[model samples]
Target: MSKAVIEFTDFSFTYRAQQEPTLRGINLSIREGEKVLIVGPSGSGKSTLAHCINGLIPFYYPGETAGSLRIMGQEQQEQSIAALSQTVGTVLQDPDGQFVGLTVGEDIAFVLENAAVPLQEMKERVTAAARAAGIGDLLSASPQELSGGQKQKTMLAGVLAGNVDILLFDEPLASLDPFTGTRTIEHIDRLQRETGKTVIIIEHRLEEVLHRPVDRIIIMNDGVIACDLPPAELLSSGLLAGTGLREPLYLTALRYAGVAVTPDLQPQHPELIRLEGAAQRLEQWVDGYREQSGPAEAVPLLELKEVTFGYERETAVLDKLSLTVNRGEMLAIAGRNGAGKSTVSKLICGFYKPSSGSIWLNGRDIGRDTIKERAERIGFVMQNPNHMLSKTLLYDEVAFGLKLRDVPEELIRERVHGVLRICGLHAFREWPISALSYGQKKRVTIASILVLEPEIIILDEPTAGQDYRHYNEMMEFLRGLSSRGITVIMITHDMHLMLEYAQRAIVLADGKKAGDDRPERILTDRSIVEKANLRETSLYTLALRAGLQQPEELVRTFIAFDREVRRR
Candidate 1:
């Protein structure tokens, strides 16, 4: 038997701010050299459990934690998160949140420096860690300049530099592009192969790690271990439904469709349910499309003409890319990290002047106006709310743009308050911006831009750090704006969002257009999904893999079939 690296015995914890304990009745043992994936919905005590592993529960969080958590055979309370660092290295959900150094090289060195390694040996360790994390080429670059994936890998490299016995990652892929996120997990898999260190990852997207060999799958709910089993038996036990976690999308789709799992079938081994329920549900959703005769408006609101953009040497992030956006169109740009997807958004918003090509907004050359003019015409909400936030209070922050435009107090009040309600921030109107959680703050930043009431609104990664319920609310709100005749262009890594919300998807690869098609078309295209490193919706994957080759048609069928099932 392998040695137990960490163990929790009947542990439960309550955060300082909450009346109820976030986690309750948790019991588990982790083995050295083992890789385990922990999953649960948001606020399910998964994070709390992870914090306990490294003693963050009491040290960083002044909370009441009952029961016992042991790290390296020492009680968790005895070891500070700092002291526990030698035994276990932890990376947070956000890479930027954990970054300690301004430059990549300096960050890696800092981890080793704390280990009190010799300067010569430290350099060797840093180099090896950086190489292992695949950030060697970016050693000298500013940490801020690296893409989301690169930033994460840099942090991973820092974690590995200490050469700890156990590594803990908290939703490491939360902020990364799907492609980069998958690659990051793959890199971690490689590290496990080479170093033989125990790894515990807290992840939301199960599909990314599903194919990777893991020692155990631990599901958490209401702060306790709901199920602990090998992958083969995990699903058949009805554990997923009880926990309310989305199973592998494909599996969920199949289960909903009423397909039976055979005795010989292995749940963990890429098994697909036969397409009975799937085809029914899929066809229903597809048939709804026929109900829509045309776009909400008649004329194109934004048009791109042979857009070619890049640095010297004729490099094109947007290679002769041409696209049309009608009033009320919500167009999502998607591709692998570092693909020219964001470049096209920057070009449209006037963040970058295209090397060649012209952009027309409302039948006028957008090139004719300055960025400020472009801002007035189109509002850009960046991925990070902190990046866009400027004011102390939530109300002021939302009103800043309108006030700058010299709008009157009466108008601003009506606009700002209305935005606050829609964005779900009216209650916190007087609170400091710093007081808001990450998701609320993001919505606030978006509300600020929305108040500007630009004809065109562009949001990058709008759904990051959001729950499914909030995701629905935000999209429903965006759909309302589209109904009011605003053009929305989104740059996103969320395939589900692209699948359900977006009317059109523009894919980029190597600084050029890969495909410009309806999202349903793009979502199921095996080549595009592979090349773009897109997360195929479980629904679509199950339908296709289950002998229902046509996903769009299946989606249509499923909607109708689901309603019928509900009705019966």
Candidate 2:
């Protein structure tokens, strides 16, 4: 008999905030030692369901839940969250949000101390957890000092210290870079293998998470248990798309080639060959990217020539690096955490001056320019939206930049309203910044800059923490800007986002340039993928693994060509 680690029997829940229940008649059974992937779209009750399992339902969130839930053979109601801690451990979205200790070591030791474990034993436990999370060197470092990926690992260390049998991972890889994300996945896998723990991963980055060897894939939609199947079965099903989930890019690609259930099950190599040829055709058919001379036509609206800079002249974050962003270009900068993508933006904004190399603006060196001087021309948006909102109200926040520039009040109002509409924040322009969702706050940041009418915009991971809908809206807005001759430079870890939004990609590895090319070309290059510690996109990998000839083409019904075919 299989041990049911987490069993939800016709469970239902209603939040105090909403008239309708968030979770309706949910029935799920996760067996011991099984690796399960919970896939869902935004607002799909995934977080709610996860909270319920880990004892956050009645304890933290106000709600009425019916039916029986068993965690570690104990009814969920029978055990307190503290008691349940012995059975299940949870790692949340923002690892930094969960930090309680000042140092990483202290953080990992927290649960042990909470459980009243002896000092000597707690020390051993903390050491093991830190080792497992791959942050042994960061023990004394403050959790505040860690990168997004490092913070997540530190949180995992905290959870691992509890020595629980079931682990709950909620969007663990969302903020992680390709290398760190994969490493985290590997650690999770190894931890499960060694300890025989049941791991439940709730993630929206399905393609990456599901690519692993999971026992089953459980899908949630509209607060309902839509499907429970093996990973292969879920991969082969079109239900993900049908349920309004953004299916993995690979699955989307295969579907494009007209490969339905059968072709997916037993991939057709000949069709893949055709698909590859088709991909090449798409590249060749890129009529819009006509050959331009020098780096000038390559000449971006913003140019950095041999730029190098540092804070106080010790260690340069950027080592004399040079880059260019053409007018109307969407350029993506990718690298592991702390690889200077953000610093590059700061350099362009003149927040820090180059020690040696010159930065060119419209072919003129602006290396010694002030941030204010650069700001008049370029807009730099940081990752954290809250930090950027200067005013209390959305309308005021959007208009803040232009107001600082001393634009006429009438013009500021007019342009702010226009940009709010374009950025999809018009309805909430009068609302307080405190009332804004993370996605909404992010859009407000973009609008704040857009109203300034900067010729070049640099966004640092614009799509971070966003759902597919928000992601699409943000990218679509950026696309419109690019069309109007604004050069969009994004520092991001999302390979798919780069592939779709950016016309060109520049990869920085080990603090230097590894690639500068179209995303299609960059992604197809194995050397680049290897150097960056990125796994192939699921569709690309599936096509490769399944021995397809034109894997990329057959993957999407080949969207671009299909659209062309439709138009023809």
Candidate 3:
């Protein structure tokens, strides 16, 4: 048996700025060469635990520590941050914040350069790390110029070059497409196997992280360890259902089909699991399922005609793209990173003008509208809340837009309070923005826009980095907005979110529309899914493995059933 490299006994931590303890009475051990996943809802103390391990708990985030904690059998308080960093290397959630060097190679070699390693040795180590990370060709490219996935790879190579025994990834899949997330998990698995290093991943996307094998999963809830077990055991125990973490889609499908999931069946991998009579049960469920009526014929509210745009004169980001969005519709814009998903949203918001075409809104040309003018009718919420929030208090932040419009003080107060309640932020109205979690901050930004009461709202990756409960809450709120005749456009890479919430999906690839259809159809179509860097959901894989003749139909039926269940 491998020795425990990380151990905690009766551990607890309280930040200097907080009154209550963030991590409480935690007892845990992680063995060397083990790959483990830690997950929980926001403010569940998972991040605090990670900070403790990476020497940031006391060194960076000044905090009070209690009980005992050890790294590699040595007391944690005895080591400096720089010394702990040599043994533990972390890849942050936002890779952009970690970049220091101009080029990929320089970034990877930054640590070695600081250590005064020989020039030849640094080059050899950097090259080897880049090749291992599958970014050898990008050595000369600027880190800022790379795609989301490429930036993550560069961060991984930089950590790998440090030759740390333990690797930690913080929300590694938050910014990646479904296909790229799977590939990243595969790469992490390969590295752990080849190097015999301990791996720890802290993420909310449970399904994506389970793509590769894991030794165990640790569930954190309210400043304590809730459960710790192996993958198969944990899935079979049904503990995840109440923890606000989503089970793998295929496993959920099995339950929906009346199949009892057991550990002996190996529930971790859908393709390998054995489900006796599952096919017949699923078929019966589908046969008994009645399809809901489609929406009334769409009334075009916004249209783009042969729009062409390019950041550089020689290279086009969007090429003669044309599409129409219906009034009171919920639309999903999806594609791989750097595939012009956000560019389309920007063009609609009047941030950039098309080079050769026009945009029409409600039968009127919007080509000459200023960005401020467009903001009155079209609201855009960025992926990062930090970029949008300016006020210190939550109430002030939400009221900023209304105040800017010279609304009466009484009217602004009523509108701000109403929007806050809808966003589930009324309780924290007077709290400082810095005290809120990442998910809560995101809601504040949305509330700021909701006060404006725009006709159409565009959210870029709204559910990214959020737990299952928070994700459901946000989508349900958006669904309510759509029911009231508000149009919503979400730029996303989450296939499951697209399947669950999006009424129509527009797929972009190489600056052109690749497919426009219902989310289930878009996800199941092999050619379109592959071309747009999306993988078929595991539910589809379950159908194919069961030899179902109509896999797409099964996917559609399952989505309908899942939505109905959630509605209750």
Candidate 4:
């Protein structure tokens, strides 16, 4: 057996700013060359454990510590971050924030250059690492010009160039499209096998990470280790759901069908899981299930006619695209990165005017409307909360929009508090923005928009950093808003979110409308799914594996059933 590369004994940590320890008594060990996944709900100490391993706890965070943490058999506190980087290479959650060079090659070489490696050696290492990361062709490309997947590869290459023994990825799939996320997992698995390195991933996307094999999964909750077991064992434990984390969708389907999920059945991977009576059980479930009716005929509320837009004149980000959003409709815009998903929201919010198209809002051309004028009817919650957040306190942030519109102070307080409570932020209303976690900040941004109560709300990647419990709460709130005649438009990469909440899905590929239909139809169609860089939901796969005649209908039925269960 390989020796332990990382070990913690009675470990605990408390940030200097906090009275309580973020992590408590974490006694764990990760062997050399092990591939481990750490997952939990938000504020579950998963990030704190990761920071401890990567030397961020003491070196950067300045936390009070207890007990021992050893990386590569060396005491963690004795080593500086620079020294730790030589053994543990960390790829942060946001790749854009990590970029320090103009081109991919230069960025990858930055680490080696910092260590004062020879120029020729640095160049060779950078090229080799880029090739290994499958981004050799993107060496000359600027980080801004690459797709999300490509940018992730660039970040991987930068870490690879460091030649570290352990690679730590922090929420690597958070911003990626479904297809890209699957590919990234494949790459990580391949890198681990080829390099014989220890791989540690901190992520909430458990099912996505389980796309490839992992040796074990470590579940953290409330500042301590909750469960540690192999993937198959963990899946069979029925602990994930109880801990407020989502189990794999296929497993959920299996349980719904009354199938016993056991470790012996190999339940970790959807394709390989053994299901003895799944076909019959699922068939009976489908027979008993009633499908929900489609949305009522939509009265067009917004329209884009031959919208052609580009940052530069020569290349259009959105090319001659056209679509309509119905009033009070819950619409989802989905595509791979760089397919102009966010750009569409920006255009509607009047951030950028279409180069040659008319934007019609309620039968009137709003191309001449200023951004402030658009804000009266349109509320946009951006993907990055940092970009939209300006207030220091949560309450102040949520109330900022209402204050600007000269709403009465008392009414603003009432509205802001209500929205904050709806968004699960009422408890943290007095907290500073910097003190909150990323997921909390996301809610703050959403609350800021919700307080305005605009006619139409546009949320970009609304649930990216959120856990399952909070995601459900937020989506339920949005569903209530939709029921009350507020139009909701979501630009998201979460396949589950798209299937569950979106009434209609608009798929764009190469900046063109590839498909427009119900979410289940868009997801079940192989061509559209691939073209839009999406994965068919595991529920769809489960249906096919169960030998169902109409897999698409099964997908739809499952979603309806799931929604009903959540509603209850």
Candidate 5:
């Protein structure tokens, strides 16, 4: 029998500023050596539950709490956060915020130093943790200079150095690419097995987290536990889609092809999931598939001609790259980390100047234009929403740009409210920015940029950590913008978003143009997908398993089917 590591009994919590409770009557228990996933839509109290476990509810956020809660067989209320830290080590969404030392080795040893360990013991613990995380070579490197995956490993090393038995990961894969995300999950799984730690992962990306086997999935909605079941049972129940959360893409594809999920199937590892008559159903679907008409002739809105740029003189981030964004088109720029995806956006926004080539907006060259001047025509929404938001209130932030342009007061109100409604921030217009969640703050940033009415919008992973509902709403809003003649260029690592919404996609590999074509073509090409480190959608795999000659064609049919389902 396993020992219970966390227990909650009829617990409820409410913020001081709000009238309604965020979490109510929650009862849960997690045992040692168990790996569990917690998923929910936005504003679903998932974070609130995590906060309660980490002692952030009453201590940091100052919320009203009731009922019994225990961690490691001790009453939560009786333990201080400092005391809880010894048992529960949390890896936050942003690893940069958790670092305390300049170098990787120093950061991992910082926890040991606080415990008054001897110098030799501290070094020993740091070395062991770094080796366990497979980041021993990065010990001398600066933490801030590491890549997203390396930074995450460093954070994990710090937690391991503390000798914690309970590990909590809060959206650990949100900032990583698909390849890196897969490796990170593997590392976490290895640590859990070797140390027998209770692993709880709070994430919106359910598929990636399930790369390893999870004992259970706990679905929360409206402050209540909606479903708690083992992975196989949960997938078979079909409750994931009903809860407004995304079911795994492979499972979704199987359902669309008329294949039922089996009781013993694993959704995360698609190769292992087997359904009776799956091949026949997929073959039939492909036989009846019809391709939609291609996109109409596009008029160029933004043009890059032989662009070459590099931070240093000898190294070029983007070398002799040429591309075009058509008016009213949605283009996705995709690649692994350091593939010049964001560099392309930076050049368009005037953050970096191209060394050899020129950039043109409409017909005029804008290579030498200032960022402020380019801001009028091109709006860039960064990955971190907090970096873009300046105003205290949501409404003020959305309206600030128009006010600066000296627009009429009446027109400003009209534009601000309109953009807020489109971005789904109209309801939170009066709320303070600090009171809003990270996802809500991201919407505010998009609204702030949208109210400027720029001809071209460049969003850097706009849906990076967003829930399904928010992602759908935001993508629909961007689609609406494209219909109204606004060019939208999305720099993202999300394969689903790229395949579904982007009519045209540009694949970047080693700072060069790898493939520029329809998203379907770019993803189906083995060389381009592998070189760019992008994952092919499960639809393609299902096509191959169904023995179809043209897998890409069948994949396009799945995309069409999904688009039609959303329309309904």
Candidate 6:
């Protein structure tokens, strides 16, 4: 008795300039009130399919299409974009880009104003929506002044005010920390359940989106629907890896321990996935596992002494924080949102001068150094790839840094080409930057910095919106940099990245150094993990559930096993 909210019949679309169809014969139906998660590798047409439903493909992108696409049982070609907006509400990846008003309440009201709604009713709707999204108190706050999570809530309130029955979230968790992401997903799930709305979430973080109960999981690959089934069936099909999507960490751990996962196993909920004989098998495996890391040989590459800074003098984002980065170290700055992780990177890059602190670069004070001078030694890649891309062509974008440094044309070309190959962007050398996807644009930014050959590289959420293939390529490239004596620091909220890539993790809580040690040691300390709002990996949870003698060994073993498996 489920009503079909969206229906696609032999739907295929190709851009005006391209010959290949982005979506090839997509025949899918999403029922009303169904919660679905759509996932795929980058360039796999997930986003394209989302655009089609929201009326962005034909209206905004100007694509050549064939076959029938319907929203609310109405053919897409018959309805205008503005008309379709009433039925479909989209919360985009970048909340800032969607904002049109100065204050949170005003932003929520702006959409209502466009629809010619009365002033009194608009006010009532905005308040109700804000309260629903749990941002009622932030109504008076400026949209620009709100935190990332708050901004997203503001957008959600705006969407809810539209009173749309079909909600589409595009990478909602990409820019959020673990705690905020979890809460946001839960809130969205509640909205869906309470309203009987059709919700379709397009995200790369499969496991995080699985926090809520998903009715179905749709896997896409190369413009085709690879698999569409219930969550348990999709996880048990063993088709995720082949489709270039990441399986849950707990499932990976179980497989590593030689446990056969059945449909009865809840892969998404690690704590709930109890196999009859799996605990004994995992315990035995952990008992035989040993740590491979040795004691750190300290050699300071960069040092921060008593740093203190804040946008407002009343509150310090970073207060008297001291840290050291050793040579050839791959370190992670781990903390909750607003815990000064990005602030630390900015201070190190000389973007902001510390109010009271000294930054030493190779035994020399860098406090007085200009940003340009600091840039010669330290390279920083921003979290948003669009902010970093300036040139139209991929080659030009990658060679921009070298050009700025007055590197000879010949050398710039050679270095750009070399870095492009390393970052997996060589094939797109002549392509327009606008034509490339978000993941490809991120690689261009990294290549642009890598060509500079800096002694230290700092990346702010480098893999935020990337798929498994691009994420692995970028991480593997960064790993290679660490092996060549470069000091690399990653400011991230991704627990998987912290546990797997970061050799050492520096935990920050309330602008103070909480823990600085091996990632395993830092993560295993439940106090520090909670203080920083970091998620405990399923591997750790599995170890505890199985009553393993050394839970730390499970962490070590999972890291080793994951790396080896990725190597293949």
**Which regions in candidate 1 have their CA more than 4 angstroms from the true location?**
9-28, 43-45, 55-67, 97-105, 135-145, 213-245, 260-265, 268-298, 311-316, 393-396, 399-432, 435-437, 451-453, 530-544, 548-568
What are the TM-scores, per candidate, against the unseen true structure?
0.82, 0.84, 0.98, 0.98, 0.97, 0.97
RMSD of each: 4.3, 4.8, 1.3, 1.2, 1.5, 1.4
For model 1, residues 1-568, the per-residue Cα lDDT tens digits are: 8889888898888877668788887788998898999987555677778777777767877778888888888887876677888788888777787777778989888867776789999888889999999988888899888888888888888889988899899878777877777688888899998999999988766766765678788988767788898866786667766776545645544555555554235656444334444456544445443432343445788998988887655455667778888888888999987787767778888888877789998788889688888888889998878788889999999999888889999999999999888776787899888656566788888999999888998999998766454565677788778878888888998876776678788887776677788776787677888887786656665555655556556654443343344335
The model with the greatest lDDT is 4
Q: Kindly indicate the candidate among 3 and 5 with the higher lDDT.
A: 3
Clash statistics: count for each candidate: 24, 17, 0, 0, 0, 0
lDDT of 2: 0.76
- Candidate 4 error regions (>4 Å): 292-294
Cα lDDT for residue 225, candidate 5: 96
Report the alpha-carbon TM-score of model 1 versus the true structure.
0.82
- Which residue pairs collide, candidate 6? none
lDDT of 2 by residue, 424-513 (tens): 778777788875545668788877887887888999878766666657666787877887888889999888787777778898876678
Clashing pairs in 3: none
Tens-place lDDT digits, model 4, residues 1-568: 8999999999999999889999999999999999999999988999888888898879888979999999999999999999999999988778898999999999999999999999989989999999999999889999988888898899999999999999999999988999999999999999999989999999989999999999999999999999999999999998998899999888887887788899999998879987676789988888898866656778999999999999998999999999999988899999998899999999999999999988999999999999999999999999988899998988998888888889999999899888888888888889889988778899999989988889999999998899998898899999899888899999999998999999999999998999999999999999999898999999898888889999888888878889888888
Q: Which has the better TM-score: candidate 1, or candidate 2?
A: 2
Positional deviation of residue 143's Cα in model 3 after best superposition, in angstroms: 0.4
Error of 2 at 246 (Å): 2.6
Q: What tens digits encode model 3's per-residue C-alpha lDDT throughout 302-386?
A: 9999999999999999999999999889999999988999999999999888988999999999999999999999999998888
lDDT of 3 at 52: 93
Q: Over the stretch 405-479, how does candidate 5's per-residue lDDT look in tens digits? A: 999999999998998887777888899999998888888888899889789999999887788988888899898
Clash tally for model 3: 0
Question: Between the candidate structures 2 and 3, which one is better when assessed by lDDT?
Answer: 3
Worst 10 residues of 5 by lDDT: 267-276
Full ranking by lDDT = 4, 3, 6, 5, 1, 2
